[model samples]
Target: MELALGELLDERLITLDLQATEREGAIRELAGLIDRAGKLADRDEYVNAVLAREALGSTGVGHGVAIPHGKSPAVREAAVAFGRSRTGVDFAAPDGRPADLVFLIAAPEGAHDLHLKALAHLARRLVHDEVREALRQAGSAHEVVRVLAQA
Candidate 1:
């Protein structure tokens, strides 16, 4: 399958100014964004799944980025929510730094391989400093989509 980050990311799910100050709170806020976008049937259930995944290991990949994801029956489809925290949040990254860019991925329970592929693709793109900077400077959800489309 061709994984298009732009397709998975809804403008409504992009928050340029994230209000959460911690990892759990950030996840909750991002999950709420996805839920409000109608990507999730149950917001709390999806949040719990993401939290469970976090318990296994921090998704904080360093470079001020954190990708928190989960597979759940509550997820209606594969979707991504992006949040930018100007103040940064403590995500327990390996580099021991706060994360300013957060991507919350929600995938349906049946899409095991597809979800992994999507996550891998996103991770690869995020490794570039340019992409991170572009996302950080993005003015709106449309701008964010434009940046991710280039990835």
Candidate 2:
């Protein structure tokens, strides 16, 4: 993947303790981070895009992970918001497991498929047990960044 996940991920985008109870809520919670970081041009539009994508198919990739993304004109740039929950949220995973690690990606419509690249890269990285364990045990946002950077 040409796009470095580290470029889209940062301490400001990481949430180690998520309070969301379900999929939609978790998405909204993470998308709010993108909005606050000034990457989202229009919160409602971007959120709608993500929800629409979810309607087409669940983004839950199994293994306690979910990657929800939106490629929309409402995004100013590519950004990722990550949340970790102690109590998992239902994401309709085929494995029938709730997701504790959630990633919300916002990509500008003109970002040249960066979102797909990020998704693929994260999928590849998270497939490793060490990476997932590091994420789960990360104590701070900086730790999360360090994990992704190294992974």
Candidate 3:
């Protein structure tokens, strides 16, 4: 099945002010957001999986964006959580700059290939300056969703 970004994103999963100043802390915060949304069956396990992925390579794709993701059995469903930090977080981005936008993606273990494809699509859309600017200027979670929907 093709995964739709709109179906995976929820306004409640968007956080305008992230409190984390570091990578791990940022991942934890985003994981907590999805967990609170009832998307993770085991929050710790899911977060650990994402951390493990980070160990392999930082997901900080630069341009002030970090896409941290993992496929694990702990995920109850495939979902994405969006967060923005006004102060920026040290996500070990390839460009060596702090990341202001974070997108944490959780996928069930069985959906490995699908996850990759979906992530690719999201990455392509995120590369557009217009989309990035819109997300940055979004005033509320609803506004964030609207911006993403337009992408």
Compare the candidates by TM-score and give the number of the best one.
2
TM-score of each: 0.96, 0.97, 0.95
* Candidate 1: count of backbone clashes, pairs at least 3 residues apart or interchain: 0
**For residues 51-119, what per-residue lDDT tens digits would candidate 1 score against the true structure?**
999999999999999999999999997899999999999889999989999999999999877677778
After superposition, candidate 3 runs with Cα above 4 Å error:
none
| lDDT, candidate 3, 18-93, per-residue tens | 9999888999999999999999999999999999999998898989999999999999988899999989987788
Error of 1 at 22 (Å): 0.6
Best of the two (1, 2) by lDDT:
2
To one decimal, what is the Cα RMSD in angstroms of model 3 from the true structure? 1.1
Candidate-wise lDDT, in order: 0.90, 0.91, 0.90
Task: Give each model's clash number.
Answer: 0, 0, 0
Clashing pairs in 2: none
